[model samples]
Target: MTAAVRDIWRHPIKAHGRERLAQVDLTVGAALPWDRVWAVAHEAARFDDAAPAWAHCRNFTRAAGSPSLMAIEAEVDEASGRIRLTHPDRPEISIDPADPADAARFIAWAGPITNPDRPQPARLVRAPDQAMTDTDFPSISLINLATHAAVAAEVGQELSPLRWRGNLLLEGLAPWAEMDWPGKRLQIGSAELEVVEPIVRCMATTANPVTGERDADTLGALKRGWGHQICGVYAVVTQAGTIRAGDPIEVRP
Candidate 1:
């Protein structure tokens, strides 16, 4: 099916906030730039601060564990290495998570929204020249708007695309068409990426991005409708190039 990019997004901090983009540059064998570049490790996390590496999602403060986090939005000041975060129930903050003082400030700001039953947000760690995406390999997630619509239809609610937390959002494809993309290449704008696998979703998808509450049973809807709990695909870039919204995407042999 023919499609074009509808939106682009990146999460500088894993599971914490999302930022929209009109254009981005994709590099071969890399995740989207600044996407999940920094991740907040919880107090009980098994992460190495001195030697930061890619740890599992369980080691971080994610929306799945704290639904309130889903409401957070972010904007990055790349030149200043700072990020501005805003939530519905909390005061807006602009801090460089890498700084000791700023990290403390952020931890305090995010403390109330985090799940009190679970480990608390602790240190902000940077991934070494790579992203902290859920996948072991650096991946760019792609979500189909048609598939999202189908899931929304099943749930009997109109859901925000932010629930998927994908890097690329595409439109004009058949519902669930991305499930067939594995092992195929997609030519998007001047970039080409190989589809690796479908992204198995989690409870985080159930939360409402606006209210940060579990308002929908997205996982249940997916299981009931498709017999699977996946809504997006993971892809690794193969060609370095620029891509933007409105650029055509075609499945390649």
Candidate 2:
């Protein structure tokens, strides 16, 4: 098996924005350091707090769902236990995950995505152990940029690589062609994460990462030719360690 570690990212807050990293420390069965560690939940969130379970959907609200959030890019300052959300057009934002005052600021940052009709305020919650991200995986994501390009060729649109929101983006395969990689084990960085699920393409893809415009039929290009509207695979960590961009990947039987 042969593979290469491409890109690494950690989203301190889901759907808000992602922070790229030179390297990340991964623990077996744990998400990369702090990737998708928390997310905002509306007071109207329809789930049982007594028995909370992770939602099995890549449900992110960005400019498509909330335009204001598009301007905020989160950065993790580990030394301060703070995540700073910066924007080109807005005032600099700094929040401490452990402080309630910062939580209020987060609520203010979210307007369109907030459901005011509900009694509880929207708060950022951490991704819990055993929580799967749209599938059964603690922490691992991969996408083949080649696949994105192939899809773009067919659709005649230039899609940015950031649109996929993947932690591992590769550069040498056809569009939506990672389907062939399922059931294989990938050696990324110093860890081995098994490719275990087929990423289900959804409406999120239609939402532009930059302009926040809605582009329908993002999946149309895939269904027309690709066996699946998937450009990547989800992985489960079989081993734990640090991985960085440019690390070689290997497929193991």
The numbered model that scores best in TM-score is 1
Give the Å shift of residue 109 in candidate 2.
1.0
lDDT of 1: 0.93
Candidate 1 C-alpha RMSD relative to the actual structure: 1.0
Which candidate tops lDDT?
1
Over 4 Å off, model 1: none
In candidate 1, position 183 carries an lDDT of 97
Predictions in order: lDDT: 0.93, 0.66
Candidate 2, 82-137: lDDT as tens digits: 88876554567788855878878876766543323434336655544644255545
All candidates' TM-scores?
Answer: 0.98, 0.84
Report the CA-based lDDT of candidate 2 relative to the real structure: 0.66
The true-versus-predicted C-alpha distance at residue 151 of model 1, in Å, is 0.5
